[model samples]
Structure formats: C-alpha cells, structure tokens
Target: MTLTLYTNPQSRGRIARWMVEETGAPYEAVILDYSTTMKDEGYRAINPMLKVPAIRHDDRIVTECAAICAYLAEAFPEAELDPRPGELADYYRWLFFAAGPLEQAVTNASMGVTPNENQQRMVGYGDFARVIDVLEQAVGRAPYIAGDRFTAADVYVGSGVMWYTQFGLVEKRPVFLDYIARLQERPAYRRAAEKDDAALAAAASGDQGG
Candidate 1:
C-alpha cells in the first residue's frame, strides 16, 4: 500500500521526512497549514492530538516522530537502518533517551526552569548538565548511536542534536559538532533539508500574499 505522510514544514515532521528519504520510500506528503487545516475533522481522525508527522501505511497508522522513524526502518529492511535483533539494546536505549530525557532536559533549560535539589530526584532528566554529559559520552564512544552501524536511532537523536546545536539550546561540544557534521554528510539529510526549506519559503510567500 502507498504511504501517506501528514506534515507541516515548521514542525517535527521534518525528521519524518528525513527518515522517509533514508528509506527510499515513495510516499505522498499532505502539508497542513498551522492555522486551521490541522484542526480539521479529516486530519483529527488520523491523530486525535491533531498533530503533524503522522504516517499511514496500509491499515496501520503511526504517530510520534521517534515511533515513525523506528517503524519506517523496520518496514524497509533493505534500508539497513536498524541493528540486528540481539544488538538492539543501544538502539532502543538512546532513541528513548533522546526522546525522553534529552528532550525534557532541553525543554526545561529553554524554559529557564530549574527544579530544586529534592525535585531533581523526581525529574526524569535529573539535571541538564548530567543529561548532556551522558549524551556526549554515548555519541563520543561510537560513530553512530547503535554501535558501528547507523540506525533509526540516529535519525531521532541526530535530529535533536542538530536542532539543539543550531539554536544554541545545547552546548556545542566537540563530540556533538563532529557527530552533526557526519549526519550532514548524508544525502538523505541534505535532500530533506532542501525540501523543507523550499516548503517554508513557499509558506512565507503565501502568507505575504494573503
């Protein structure tokens, strides 16, 4: 069955587009305007949250950027974007780490919210410093997140690294700089960037016209 991708240029949907490019999958993209289209009834049926970056493959529907990355990797085995079954510990570990701890840490930091000492214990990310240190070590040890091979984990984690570093939300350590440099070298990543940039430009022009 043909795949349908629901996305907005400015949203996390860019990550899903990159994953689709990596998979070499032919899919139709449905770009929704941030104003009203996303809240429409048709789009709401696919995602109750009315969010972008959801995918429909045959009878299956997948939401969430990280979930979509992993799903696409598994769906297209020829892409070789996932580690073998037995060697998947790091794959699952860092993917969730980026999605959960790393994301929360960055968000908290961006919002200028620092929990008290006692509250830190209850926080999933502990502290931003600790989260950065762990993530730096994880990527520093290997060229890719899931050991020697590049996997879907990198798509999600790398996107976080790329976005965070670009906006100065995270420290630009040498390890992160090098890792993002490597990710940028990929053809799929370049293709996705160009496509998103064009989409954003078009949207801006449309807004100016109306």
Candidate 2:
C-alpha cells in the first residue's frame, strides 16, 4: 500500500513528517499552503477541518498528529515503534496524556487562557504548572516516554517538548531539554528537520522574489 502525507512545512505537520521518517517507509508528500491549496475544495475532501498532516494510507485516512504517529507505528510493524507487552501501559498512558492534557495545557497557557481554581475542575489538565510538573516527572522517569525504549509516543511527546521549549510555550527545564536533545540526535529526526527547513527557506525565497 502506498502512503501519502498531506502537510505544510510550518505547522504541526512537522510532527507527522518526523513520524513518517521514523517509519523508514517510502511515501509521497503533498505540500499545501495554508491560504491556497489547504483551503481548496479538493483538499477539504480529505480533511474537513482543512488541516495539514493528514495521511492517506491506501484507502485509510488518518488525521491529527498524535493519531498519525500512532497509526503509522502500528501500520509499519517493522519499524518497531509499537509498544511491547511490558511497555503497553506506559505507551498508551503517556501517548494519550501528551495528546490530550499536555497539548491542552501548553496551548492554553500560550494563549493566556489559564483557568481559575473553580474552572480547573472542568479542565482535564487542571493547570499549566501541574501539567509541566507531571510532564517533568514523566520524561524523567525513564530514558523514553513508554519505558527504556523509544516508541511512537516519543515522536509526539518529544516533538511537543522540542517545539514548546523552543517557542517559549513551555519552560526549558533540564529534563525536557535532555529528552529533546536525545531525540534530536536520531537520524530520522535530523532528516525530517532538514527537509522541512529546506521547504521553509524555499517558501521565504519565493515570497521575496514575488
């Protein structure tokens, strides 16, 4: 089956790109621009949300960066990104935790949307500080998010730590920096970043020429 990735260079699509690279599978990338191709009717057919980073694996369509990471891990078993028997609990637990609470907490904090004490009960992450503390504990507990080995969960959570820290959305704690440093050293991660960086440069050059 052929895998196709629909993404933009400068979005959460980078997370999906890294996941695809980790699979070591041959795939086609369809780059979309937010104001043009991304909003087109044809693209909307694949994702009504008009979002990038959606993948078409033969007849299957998977959207959301976390979902894409998890789906690709399962789809390409040879990649060994899937969790082993002993790692199952930590794998699913942290993966969903990063996708749900962590993301919500970071994004909300970035936009100055902190919830009050009463409102904290209604939110899944409670508060930004608590979320950061929990995340610090998670990454500090092991060499990888799911256990001693790296898995698809790291792709999502690592990307979150990398991006959040770089952009000041989250704190640059010793643990987060250490975790992301390890992940950044991976060949697949390097390759994915180079590709996106080239794309971003090309887009900027095009804008200047026009």
Candidate 3:
C-alpha cells in the first residue's frame, strides 16, 4: 500500500497519525504547518474539502479523522485494531455521535455560546449539560465503546476527549480525565507524539538558523 498521509500534528490529524503507526506499514507522512494552505487548490485535488488527515491508499483517497482511522485499521487487519462485523452498529454510532454532539458542544463552549438549559432544543448539542450526560452514559459502560474489547472508536473518542479537555471546552470530570490519561499510555500514541515533537523541534531550530 503506497499510502501517503497529509496531516498537521496540531490538527485532528494526530489521531490519523496514531492509526498509521498502528498500521505498521511503509507509508509516507507529510506534515503541514498552519502557514500552509492545506485546502488550497493544489492540495484540494486530493480532498476538495481541503481537510487534514487525508490519505492516499493506493488509488483510494480518504479524508476525515475518524474515517481515516477506521479505514486504515480495516485495511491492515493484521494490526487488530479494526472493528468486526458485529461491532458495526455501536462503532458507527459512537463515532458519529462524537463527530456531531462532541464538536457542536465543544465549539459552543469554547465560544461561550452554549444554550441555556431551558432553551437547549434551540441548540445543536442541546447545551453542554445534555452532551455531558449522554457521553457519561455511553462511556461509563465500557471496557471500550463497542464493549469487552478495544476498537477504532477509542482512537476517535480518546482524541476528542483529549482535545476538548486541552481547549477547556469540557469540565475536568474524573471519567474523562482518567480516560485521557489511559489513552495517552498507548504505545502508538507515544510513537506518533514523539515523531511529531521531534519534527516540530527540528523545524523550530531551523527557523532560528534562518
């Protein structure tokens, strides 16, 4: 598989980076800085929407973080992080739930635009309280999202929780705090983070010389 990932370490693409590391394949990774137009006409040819975490898998180009992570795990099932047929429902459910409610709530919280509890139906995530309640139910039940075993869902939710916490979009609840800490202990996450840090450091040193 001549896979090439176009990503930014600071973006949601970090989840994709961990997936690629888990893939254990000889894939090329291109890191884009904030100054670059990742969605510019040139890069947009790979993904017209111009999003990071896009990958060229042979002839199949894929975009979006969770999509890329889900796809790669299946494409490299020897890696074993892939979801099975029976887990399909919950896998897609939690991932989609995260993509929708998690983003809306987190963005609203960051912008201080969360809806009042009474007028929640007027908002997308129905206020941060509702969002938190829903997550507490789903997450608190699991050895993983699909239950009993780890799957690609963890990668997506783990990243979402980690990011929202970083942005102070979510309250520091024990469950989320513990989840993030546990997720960070994954070897694949360590590998990608180490690579990203080293690359960032080298780039910083280069700018100093210039």
lDDT per residue, candidate 1, 57-77, as tens digits? 988999999999999999999
Give each model a TM-score.
0.96, 0.97, 0.88
User: What pairs collide in candidate 1?
Assistant: none
Q: Across residues 56-171, which tens digit of lDDT does each residue of candidate 3 receive?
A: 99999999887887898889889888778888888888888898887878787778785776768766677787787788777777667777677888889878888877867777
In order, how many clashes per candidate?
A: 0, 0, 0
**Which has the greatest TM-score?**
2
Q: Candidate 2 on 145-195: residue-level lDDT in tens?
A: 988999999999999999999999888999999999899999999999998
Note the Cα lDDT for every prediction shown: 0.91, 0.92, 0.79
Spell out the clash pairs found in candidate 2.
Answer: none
Model 3 spans > 4 angstroms off: 37-40, 116-119, 207-210
On the 0 to 100 scale, the lDDT of residue 156 in model 1 is 97
Candidate 1 to truth, TM = 0.96
- Write down the TM-score for model 2: 0.97
